[model samples]
Target chain A: MTTTLDMTALDLRQVNTRLQAAARAQANEDYVITNPRGSHAMACGLDGPLGVTIKGSTGYYCAGMNKEATITVEGSAGPGVAENMMSGTVTIHGDASQYAGATGHGGLLNIKGNASSRCGISMKGIDIVVHGNIGHMSAFMAQKGNLVVLGDAGDALGDSIYEARLFVRGSVKSLGADCIEKEMRPEHLETLAALLDKAGADARPEEFRRYGSARKLYNFNIDHADEY
Target chain B: MCGIVGLFLKKDDLRPRLGDMLTDMLITMTDRGPDSAGIAIYGDAEAGRTKITVQSEDPARAFADLDAAVSEALGQPVTLTVVDTHAVLIVPDDRVAEATALLEDRGLRVMGSGASMEIYKEVGLPRDVAARFGLRQMGGSHGIGHTRMATESAVTTMGAHPFSTAPDQCLVHNGSLSNHNQMRRRLAKKGVFTRSENDTEVGAAYISSRIAEGASLGEALDGTIRDLDGFFTFVMGTRTGFGVVRDPIACKPAVMAETDDYVAFASEYRAFADLPGIEAARVWEPEPATVYFWER
Candidate 1:
C-alpha cells in the first residue's frame, strides 16, 4: 500500500519518525509527501527499500544518509541533498543548490537540472549524473565515485581528485591540481554508457571526455615538490 | 551566516500587507542569523516633504525637543514620531540637509533619510526586533531586511544591517567582502563617507557613489563583480525598485520568487512559502555576477 504524508500538517520530526519505524518493520510500502515547502531534513536516515516521492521543493540535507530507499523530488532541492548516502537512488526533477550529493558512499544521484558549487565534494563512492551545468569546485577531494555531466562545468572541476572518474560532455573551465584529461578508450566509453543508461540520460557516450587523477600527488613524492 | 529578504510590490492591493509579509519572511530565517536584525521600508512619499529616521540609545530624552530644536534651526515646520528607540523626523525638502546636520550635532545618529524610506535596526532576535518596531502594522510599497550573526563585526545596534549611506538607498548583505578596507578608502577619495566600521556599509557606499557618478543600478552591481572580492549576495532597495546580485563565486545562498503582485527575495525558500499565491509564483535562483531588479 502507498502512504500519503502532507508536510503542511505534520511536523518534520513526526514524518521522519514514521519513516524510520516503517523502515525498521521492513514494510514494502510507498510514500507520497506533499507540500514540503522547503523544510529541511525530510526523509533522512532511512535504511529500507521503500519508495518516496516528494511533491515540492525541499531545504538543506534532504534525504541524507540513505541506505536502500528510493527518493524522488518533484521540484528543486536546497544544499546537501543526498549527502553521505549509501545504497539508494535519489533523483531531483529540478535544479539542486550547493554541495549536492556531497560525500556519499554508494548510491545513484541524478539531477535533471543544473547543480551549484561543490556538487560531489569528498565523495567516497557514489555515481552522480547531471543533465545540465555544474558550478565551480565540483568533485573536490573526491576519493572514489563516478560523476557524469552532460552540460558545461564551471571553474575548478575535480580539484585534488583521487580514484573518482569524471565525464563531461561540454567544455570545462579549468581542471584542478592533479586532475587531468585521460584518453577515452572503449572501456571508458562502455562505463559512460552504463552510467548514462542508469541515469536515463539521452546523451550519447562518445560525446563525453573522461577525466581522472594523474597519480602525481598520490604519495607526496619529493621529485614533484616544485609543483606543490 | 546571515539572512536577507526583500519585497517589491507591483500591485496596489498587496501594499498594505507588505510589512506583514516581510516580517514573516525574516522570522523564518532566524536560524541562519540570530544575533541582530534590521529593516528598511519605503512608504508613500508626500510632496515637498522628506523624512529622516534616527535611532538613539535613550529615545525619551533624545526625541523630546528634537522637533522644536530642528524646526527652529531650519526655520520651518518639523514633526517627530517616536517608535521605541527610533524616531522619524519629517521636514521641508529644501532643508533636509540642514535638518540632518542639526540632528547629528544634537547627538542623534541618522539611520536613513529620503522622501520615502525609513530604517530601523537593533541588536536582538529578529522576532523580538520586529515586534519592538511594530513592523507588521506598518505599510510600504517596498522593503528589505537583514538578520546578522556578527561574523566580521561586533554585535551592536550600529553594527546591524540594512546599512544606508545615501538617500533612498539601503543595502543588506549575506556574505563577507575581502577588500572592504581598501574599497572604503577608495570611496572616501571619491567623497562618499561611511559611518560605521561594518563592511556592508562600505558596499552600500560603493554602489551609491557609483550611482552618483551616472552609473545605473545594474551597472554598479556589475562593477561590484569586477572590483569587490569575496562571497556576497546583496539585496538593495531604492525609492522605486529592488535589486539583487550575487558574487562570482556565489558561496552565499539566495532565492527569488516573482508573481503578478510582488517580487520577493530571501536566503532560502521557506521565506516564500507563506506568501499569498506563492504556489503559482515563478521561483528561481539568481545567477552569479548578474543583477535582477524590479521597478513599478
Candidate 2:
C-alpha cells in the first residue's frame, strides 16, 4: 500500500512520528511524502523493509541511520544526507550539500548530481556512488567501504584514508597525506562494475582508477608521528 | 548558527516586492537564529540626497524636532522619517560629513549613511523586527537580511548583523572570524575604526576600508579569502549590486539559486522553498573560496 504524507498540514514531529511508527511495524509498505520543503531529518532512523519517497527537496540529515528501508529524494538534499546508515539504499536525484554521507556503518548512497565538500568521511562499510563531482576532503579517514566517483574530484581526495577502496573516473586535484593511486586489478574492476550497475550509472568500470591507503599510517611510529 | 538571505532582482517589476520577498525569506530562517535580526534595503536614491539611518534608545525625546534642529544648525533642509525606534534623515549629499558629526554630538547612534541604502536592526526575533519596521510595505531594488544567533558578541542593538561601515554598502555574516582582533588592529592603524566589539563589525570595516582604498568589490571579496581566517559566508549589498563569498573550509552552509528574474542566497534551501518559481531556479551550493557578484 502507498501512503501519502503531506508536510504542510503536519508539523515536523508529527511527520517523523508516523514514519517511525510505520517502520517499527515492519508493514512492508510504500510511503510518499509531499511538500518536504527542505525540512531536516525527514525519513530518518527507519529499521524496516519499507520504501519511502520524498517528493521534493530535504534539509540536513535526510534518511539518516537507516537499517533496511529504501529512501529516495526526488529533489536536492542538504548537508549530511544519509549519514551513518546501518544498511539500506538512499538515493538523491539532485545535488547534495556538504558531507553527503559521513561515518556510515553500511548502506548505499547514490547521488545523481554533484556533492559538495566532504562527500564521504569516515565510513565503516558504506558504499557511495556519485555520478557528478565531489568537493575536497572526500573519503577522509575512511576505514572500510567502496566510494566510486564518475566525475572530477576537488582538492585532497581521500585524506589520511585507510582500507576503503576509492574509484574515480576523472581527474583528482590532489591526494591526501596517506592516500595513493593503486593499480586496479581484475577483482577491483569487477567490484566497480557491480557497483555501477547497482547505482544505474552510465559509465564503464574500466574507465575509472582506484585509490587507497599506503598502509604506512596503520601502525603509529613516533618517528613518523607527524604524518599521522 | 546564523541565517542570511539576499535577493538581487534582474527585472524591474520585482524591485517593488523586494522587501516582501526578503522578509519572507528571513522569517523562514528564524529557527536558525533567534537572538537578533536586521535588514538592509537599497531603495530609490533621490538626486543629491543622502539618507542617514539613526537609532535612538528613546525616540520620543531624541527625534523630536531633531530635523529642525539639524536644519537650523547646518542651515540646510533636513527631513526625518521615524519608524518605531529608528529614523531616516535625508540630508544634502555635500553636507553628509557635517551632518553625521552633528548627529553624533546629540548621542544618536548612526546605523548607516548612503544615497539609497537604509538599514534597520534590533535585538529581537526576525519576525518582530520586520513587523516593528513594517518591512513588508517597503520597496527596493536589492537587499540583504540577517538573523543572528550571537556567537562572537553580545545581543545588543549594535551587535546585530548587516553591519554597515561604508556608504551604500552593508554585509551580513553567518560565521565567526578567528583573526578579527588582529585585523581590527591593522585596520585601525590605517584609520578605519569599528564601533562595536563584535567580530563581524571588524569584517565589515575591513571590506569598507579596502573599497575606500579603491579596490573593486570583487577584489575586496578576494582579499577576504586571502587575509581573513575562520569560517564565514558573507552576503554584501551595494548601491547597484550584491556579492557573496565563503571561507575555504566552507563549514558554514550556503545555498544559492538563480533564475532569469532574480538571484538569491540563503544559508539553507528551506529558506528558498517559498520563493516564486523556485522549482525552476538553478539551485546549487557555492564553491568555497569563490566570489559571486551580480551588478545592475
Candidate 3:
C-alpha cells in the first residue's frame, strides 16, 4: 500500500515525522508528496527501505543525510539536493542548482538534467551520475567516489581530487590541479557499465574518458612546495 | 546574498503591467535580502527633454520652491513632481548638466538623471518601499529591482542598489568584487567619479565609462569578465536596452526566462512562479561569463 501527504495542508514537521515513524517501524509501503512548491529539507534523515516521491520542485537541502530509502523528485531542485547521504538512491527528474551533492559518504544520486557548480565536492564513497552538463569546480577535493557526466563539464573539473574517479562522455573545458586524464581499461569499463545499469542511464560505457588524481601533491615535498 | 529582478517587455501590450510584475518578482526574494531595496523604471522618452530623479531626507525643506529655484538657475522652465521621498525634475536636454550642477550645489543628492530612466531606493524591506513609491501604479516598457543585504558598505540610502553612474545607465549587482578599489582608482583617473563606497558603484561606473568611450553594451560586458576580478552577477539597464552578465566562476545564482511578450531575470526560479504566461515561457540559467541583452 501507498500513503499520500499533501504539503499544503500538513506542515513539513508532520510529514517528516510520518516518514520517520514509518522508517522506525520498518514499513515497506511507498509514500507520495504533493504541492512541494520549492520547500526545503524534504525526506531528509531517512533510514528505511521504503520509497518516497515528491511531485514538485524543492528548495535547499531537499534530502540531506539519507540512508536506505529511495527518494525521487518530479521537478527541479534547489541547492544541496542530497548532501551527505549514506545509502540507497535519490533521483531528480529536472535540473538541480549549485552544490547538488556536497560531502556525501555513500549511495547514488542521479540527475536527469543539468546540475550547477560543485556537484560533488568533498565526497566519500558516493556515486553521482548526471545526464546533462555540470558547472565548474565539480568534485573538488573528492575522496573515494565515482562521478559520471554525460555532457560537457565547466571549467576546473575535479580540482585537487584524491582517490576518486571521474568519467565524462563530453568535452572538458579544463582540469584542476592534481587532476589528470587516465587510461580507461576494461575494468573501468565494467565498473562504469554496472553503474550505468544501476542508475538506469542510457549512455555507452565506451564513450567515456577517465580522469583521476595525479598523486603529485599527496606529500609535502620541497620540490613541489611552489605548486601549492 | 542579494536578489535581482528585471523585466523587459518585447510587446507594447505588457508595458502597463511592468511595475506590478517587477514588484511581485522582487518581493518574492525578501528572505534573500532584507536590508534595503531599489528599482529603476524606463518610461516613455520625450524629445529634447530629460528628467533627473533626486531623493532627500528632508523633502519638506529640500523640495521647497525647488522647481522655481532650478528654473531660475537654468534660465528655463522646469517641472517637479514629488512622490514621497523622491522627486523628478524635468528640464530641457541641453540644460541637464546645468540643472544637475545647480541641484548638487544646493546640497541635493541626485539618484539618477536621464530622459527615460527614474530610480528609487531606500534602506528598508522591499514590500514597504514598493508601497511607499506606489510601484504598482507606475508603468514602463522595462524595469529592474534589487533587494540588498549590505555586506561591503554602510547601510545608508546612498548605499542602496540600482546605482546609476551615467545618464540613462544603471546597474544592480549581487556578489562581491575583489579588485574594485584598483578599478575605482583607474576609472577615477579616466574622469569617472563614484559616489559611494559600495563596490557595485565601481562596476556601474566602469560600464558607464566604457559606453561613453563608444563601446557597445555587449563589448562592455565582455570587458567585465576580463577586467573585473571576483564573483558577480550584474543586471544593467540602459535607455533603450537591458543587459545581464555573470562572472567567469559564476558563484552567484542567476536564472532567465523568455516569452513572446517579454524577457525576465531573477536570482532564482521561484520569482517567476506568478508571472503571466510563465508556464509557457522558455526558462534556463544564463551561461557563465556570457552577456544576454535585449533592446526595443
Candidate 4:
C-alpha cells in the first residue's frame, strides 16, 4: 500500500504525526512525503520497518533514528540526518549538510551527492557511501564504521579514529591522528560493491583508496605521549 | 545557561571506572554553574547507576515541590531522600521527563542529568566547588557540567547554567549574541515567551522551539546559525553528551581533545589540564561555524 503526504500546506508537527502514523500502519510498506517547497524533519525517529520517500529537499534530521526501514530523499538533507540510527537504509539524492550519519550504530547511509563538513563524524558502526565529495573533518572520531568517499575529502578525515575503515577516490587535504592511507585489497573492493549496491548507486569500488587507523592510540605508552 | 551529560555503552560493556572518571570530571567543571549542583550515575549502586545531583536556593521547598510534582506526574510517591539542601535522587526509569518538568516548572533550573551527571555551583571558587556540593567522592561514566555568570540579568538561584530549553535539552554559552534581543522580540511575536533575559536561554529556547516544530538539534542549530549574529561558544548537553557550536566571528574560547578512549573538553585547555587524571590529552580549537557533539 502507499500513503502520500503532501506537505505544501501542513506544518512540521502535522507532518510528523501523520508520518509516524503511516510508519506504524504497515510493515515494509512505502510512504511518501512530498512538498513542492522543501521543509524540515520529513521522516524522523521511525522505530519499525517502512520505506519513506521525501520527493523533495528536507531541512534537518530527515530519517533520523531509523530502525529496520528504508528512506530515500529525492533531494538534499540538512544537518543530522540518519543521526543515531540503529539499522536501515537512507539515501540522499542530492548534496547534504554537516554531521551526516553522526553517531549512527548500524545501517546503510548513501549520499549520492556531495556532503558538507563533518560528514559521518563520531560514527559507531554504520556504513556510509558518499558517491560525491565530502567536506572537512569527514569521519572525525569515528569509532567503528565503513566510510566510502567516491570523490575528494577535506581536512582532518578520520581524526581520532578507532577501527573505522575509509576509502576515498580523489584528493585528501589532511588526515587525522592515527589515520593513514592503506592499500586496497579485493575484500575491500567487494565491501564497497556491497555498500554501493545497498545505496542504489552506480559508482565502481576500484576508484577509491583505503584508509584506517594507525593503531597508535591503542595501549598508550610513554613514547606516544607527545601525540596526545 | 544549562549543562547536560549522559553515557551509552557501545559494546554492551562499559570501561571500568569510566563512569566514575566522568563524575570526577563533571565535578571538576562545576564552575560552569555557580548556582546549584547535582549528579546522576547509572550502573550498580555499589558501582553506581546514573547519579544526579542538583543545587537550589530554596533546596527544601524545591525538593518538596519536586517530590510532590514527580509523584503527581508519575503516579508514584517520590522518595529520592535527602539531607540538607542537596540530595541524589534514584530517578526511576521513564520518570526523567516527569521529574525534570516538575523541577523546571517550579522555577528550579536543572543543570545536568545523566550518569554521574550534575550541574553544580554556588558562588565559590572552582577549586572548592565539589566539596561545597557534597561531591567529595563520587564517580560515573561520561557526563557534562557547567558554570554561569549571568550578566544583564538577576543572578537568582534559578538562573544558572544548564538552562533546560526543552524537556531533556540543556545548553551553556560563553559569549553574548548580538541578535538575542531582536530574536527574543521575534520569538515573542510568535507566542514564544521570553523566560529570562539571558541570551543563552534564548538560544536554548530557539533550538527547543525548533525541536518542538520538528527540527533536530543539529538541523535547528545549523539552520539558525546564520540568523544568529554576534559571538558565542554554545555548549549543549542533552540525554546525550556535549553538543557544541561556535559563531563565525565571535567571542568565547573552546579547546577540545578527542581520543578513542575519551573526549574531554573545556572552555580553555587549562580546565582539561586541571583534571587530576587527564594527562597527555590532545587539545585543539574548533573552527568557526563548526559544530561538535559527543555521545557516551
| Per-residue lDDT of candidate 1, residues A29-114 (tens digit) | 79999899899998899988888899988999999999889999998899899999998899999889889989999999999999
Model 3 Cα lDDT, one tens digit per residue, A1-228: 989999889999899899978976789779999877567788898887778999877777888888888999988888888999888789998888888888988999999999988889998999999999999999999998899999988889989999889999999999999999999999999999999988888999999999999998788889866877
In terms of lDDT, the best-performing candidate is 2
Q: Any runs in candidate 4 off by more than 4 Å, and if so which?
A: A36-38, A224-228, B1-296
Tens-place lDDT digits, model 4, residues B117-223:
44454544333554554543444444444555556456654455556655446666666677889889888887776566877678887877887888767777775
Worst lDDT 10-window in candidate 4 chain B: B2-11
Model 3 TM-score relative to the real fold? 0.94
- C-alpha-based local distance difference test score of model 2: 0.93
Docking class of 1: medium
lDDT of 4: 0.67
Q: Which residue ranges in model 2 land beyond 4 Å of their true spot?
A: A225-228
Regions more than 4 Å wrong, model 3 = A1-25, A225-228
The fraction of correct interface contacts reproduced by each prediction comes to: 0.52, 0.76, 0.05, 0.00
B181-277, model 2: which lDDT tens digit per residue? 9999999999999999999999899899999999999999989999999889999899999999999999999999999999999999999998889
Q: Write the per-residue lDDT of candidate 2 for residues A36-149, one digit (tens) a residue.
A: 999999999898888999998999999999888899999999999999999989999999999988998897999999999998899899999999999999999999999999
Weakest 10 consecutive residues, lDDT, candidate 1 chain A? A20-29
Candidate 1 Cα errors over 4 Å, as ranges: A219-228
Compose the digit string of candidate 3's lDDT tens values, residues B1-296.
99999999999888888999999988987877899999999998889999899999999999989999998888888999898899999999999988889888888899998989999999899999999899988899999999998888988889999999999999999999889999999999998899999999999999989989999999998889999998899999999879999998787888888999989999877788778887667767788889999998
Give the whole-model CA lDDT for all candidates, comma-separated.
0.91, 0.93, 0.90, 0.67
